[model samples]
Target chain A: MLRDITLGQYYQADSVIHKLDPRVKLGTTIIFIISLFVFQGAWGYAVAALFLALVIKLSKVPFQFMVKGMKAIVFLLLITVIFNLFLTPGEPLVTVWKLTITKEGLRMAVFLSIRLGFLIIGSSVMTLTTTPNQLTDGLEKMLKPLNKIKVPVHEIAMMMSIALRFIPILMEETDKIMKAQLARCADFESGNLIKKAKSLVPLLVPLFISAFRRANDLAMAMEARCYRGGDNRTKMKPLHYEKRDYIAYAIVACYVILGIAAGKLMPLLVSGIIQLV
Target chain B: MPIILDKVSHVYGQDTAMAVTALKNVSLVIPDGQFIGLIGHTGSGKSTLVQHLNGLMKATSGSIYFNGEDIDAEGFDKKMLRSKVGLVFQYPEHQLFETDVFADVCFGPKNLGLSKKEVELRAYEALKLVGLEDAYFYQSPFDLSGGQKRRVAIAGVLAMKPEVLVLDEPTAGLDPKGRDEILDQISRLKKETGMTVILVSHSMDDVAKYVERIIVMNKGSVMYDDAPREVFRHYQELEQIGLAAPQVTYIMKDLQDHGYDVSDEATTIEKAKEEIKSWFARLSAVGKGR
Candidate 1:
């Protein structure tokens, strides 16, 4: 039952977006998130939405799959929306018992929720399109300048790739341990909060032991192969930008510039649309 | 009075592009107190089928009944079903978690909500049944040898006193001697308690020697379900499906092919020896008559 995790999972699809260098995807994802915060008016958000839709469509990853990742953040979204809806002080639009519903509060809540949502989808676009190895390679290359100040960029990247590789393995291990414990009549459900926590001891202890054993074995295997902290390592599939990557950069740069310009020229644009209509 | 699976089919990752049909429309009736061997090639759905018996997994389509009650039905008391049908998973030794061997064995009975005294009593009995001496009872389970840890893990399930014990590759990583020891203990336990035992194994000889019935699964379907002799008679078909009959089955078949009066269906060495011995007596009697 624990196999529903979608974050950091790659969706295989043959598309221009997937073919672009991982550095382009990484840089654009950050730019997109920053643009979400920079956009203030409906016109700016509209431009951002159009850009995001174009990219998602181009990537060929299913829309429903992207939306599925939003489920994991619903509770956080709700708390942010509720707190903003009730606590923000402004000109009151409605009153419900002790809670004050102000115009600005409603606006803030809607905009904040939208921002949080856009944040997840924006980041997922990069993770869903790029494989984990390419991601680490891009990161290591991007952070190479930091190596001049002894940041150990290669080691950090190596660790990240290893961690990403083990996620599914450990998840499968946990599933097996849970089933084994369950067969012995161990109840993980139908208990009070503390009791439930206590019930996890049987599941957790075995999992921890297995994890350690696996880690030890992995370390020995790596040592046997003469791995020494990513030192003097050559890339098997090194990261390099193609023509599409430069075009992607231009698109993202134009998006940010347009988003900011749309906020400034919002009134003119709305009046022009109205006159046209 | 049998555990029944009615046209049960299971599909992993159902309704998705990656979906795989793990079990076909397979139906089975496992009677009480019967020792059955479940044999199949790897990924042949042997593990999935056994997991269904204890409700560890639900069928994607179809139902399983335990003693005339629908197990997957709402409010079916699955916990009780699990206690009744104990499943010792592959590498069960990896599931031990308590500080000591005895406490680990007691984990199952305690989860059954039995009294403290009863939990310890059953744990003691189970450990004894598995032939673990008292000296190792207080030692940490992690410190034991591979075979000892496996026996302790088996006793942990046995402590729950399941009516039907299902073991999935219990002797997978053990040496030949250890494998024999554990299987012998399980056979003795079956004889002493008359409980239904289902052994899932890759070793043809082990199943042919110990189990009363053999169930051959291939590509998520049962190809044969009969007594050992009856099933081994179709050894040619079994081998074609990436499985083999016991070595003795091959020997008996070779003897018959060389013009000897011996049954080719003997599935075990002892039975083959008897068949050959009687064949010799018949040959000597015919020689005297001539």
Candidate 2:
């Protein structure tokens, strides 16, 4: 059941997108997100969507898996739509039972939802293709220049990689604790809200204990292996940007230019109801 | 009542990109009152199979029956099923949560919605079954030694008065003495309460010494299921699957191959010694007749 959580999960695949430098992928994802928000008209949105679809396809990740990743943000998307649809003040396009639905409100809701959806999927594409270790290595290297300014870039990346690596281990541990409690006839699924929360005590206590134990053990193990931070560390797999990374960046640049051009050229087609009103 | 699994198959993350077949089409019947041992390497689906016996996992296809009733059928109270088939997971002591040993053990019975008096009664009785002293009941479980913590965890399950107890590697991290102590307590519990016990272990000696029947699993399939002696007879097959017969069985096989007249099928040290003694007696008699 815990395996179903696809948020920030990395999928292993051998594709050009997967082989690109992680720093390049990370940078392009940020740029793509910015372009998603900048593009306003249908043509601009279409170009941005096409670019995202192209990147996802190139990554060789299944479309369904990306949709699964989107499952977590469905609530956020719904909230955005609901808030915009009901609260935004504009010229009413449809009125019924003292409820007014405006063209601008509906437009804003759809545009915002679509933009948020693209933002999530676009960034997830990078994570799905790159391993956590690679992502951290890239981040550390990308942020190396900031070290001159006394920023703890390496420490941050190290923490991120460690966190990512332990996520699955911690999840498995939680499942085992829950099963053990269940074996003792602890009813976790049924019961009123308070009663259900009470059932979690057995599971939570052990999980916290085990997590602390693991953290201590890991720290000691790292120290034993001479893992002193940042000063004299050499990576086994160094991050290197290849020719393909440059090409990928070029494509992203072209996408931005096209997005800007489309946004300026297209006539704002606000769902036919706006002209009728 | 016997536990029967019929053509059960389990697939993790079904219909997803990360899908994995953890258990293939498998079927087995565990007779009531029998001490059954489940042996498998890591990821052989042994853990997954045991989880199904108590309804912790729903088989992707097929059914599990307890007392001839379909446990997988809708509306079957899974809590009752879980209470009946007690499972003690590996490193179970890690699940101990209550402040005091008594409260931790009583947690199970209390969750059963029993009266407070009944819960306390069963809690004390269960602790006694695991050989924990009454004086230790009020002390914090965290204060206990590793072995004692493990026993307290087992007692917590025993408080539910399960008909069948399933333990997954009960002695995994314990020292040799602690391992023997825990296993002896479990054996005694079986004898005194007449509860059916299923022990899951990777150690051949543990299974050979304590269980009557052994079920060997490899790669999500049941490779062998029979008496310990019968399973050991296929020592070569067991070795091929990254498993070994009990140490005594290996020594017996070696002694037999060296012309010592010892039976290769002896699974335990006592049985091997008996066979060797009987062979010596027959040899002396033959020499006298000659």
Count of clashing residue pairs in every prediction? 0, 0
lDDT of 2 at A181: 88
Residue pairs clashing, model 1: none
Clashing pairs in 2: none
Q: Residue-wise lDDT of candidate 1 within A1-277, one digit each (tens)? A: 8887788789999999999998898889888898899887888888989999999999999988788899999999999999999899999999999999999899999999989999999889899999999998999999999998999999899889988998999899999999999999998997799999999999999999998898899999999999886567888887777788899899888999989999879878789999999
Model 1 chain B: lowest-lDDT 10 consecutive positions: B13-22
Shift in Å, residue A15, candidate 2: 1.3
- The per-model lDDT (C-alpha) reads 0.92, 0.90
Candidate 2: tens digits of C-alpha lDDT, residues B1-290: 78999999999988865688988888999888999999988888999999999998999998999988999788898889989999999999999999999999998999898999999999999999999998899999999999999999999999999999999999999999999999999999999999899999988988788889999999888989999999999989888888899898888878878888767878878888898889999999999999
lDDT for each residue of candidate 1 in B2-93, tens digit (9 for 90 to 100) = 79999999998886667888899889999999999999999899999999999999998889999999998999998899899989999999
Candidate 2 ranges beyond 4 A from true positions? A268-277
Q: For model 2, what share of native contacts is present?
A: 0.94
Taking the candidates in order, what DockQ does each have? Answer: 0.80, 0.83
DockQ of 1: 0.80
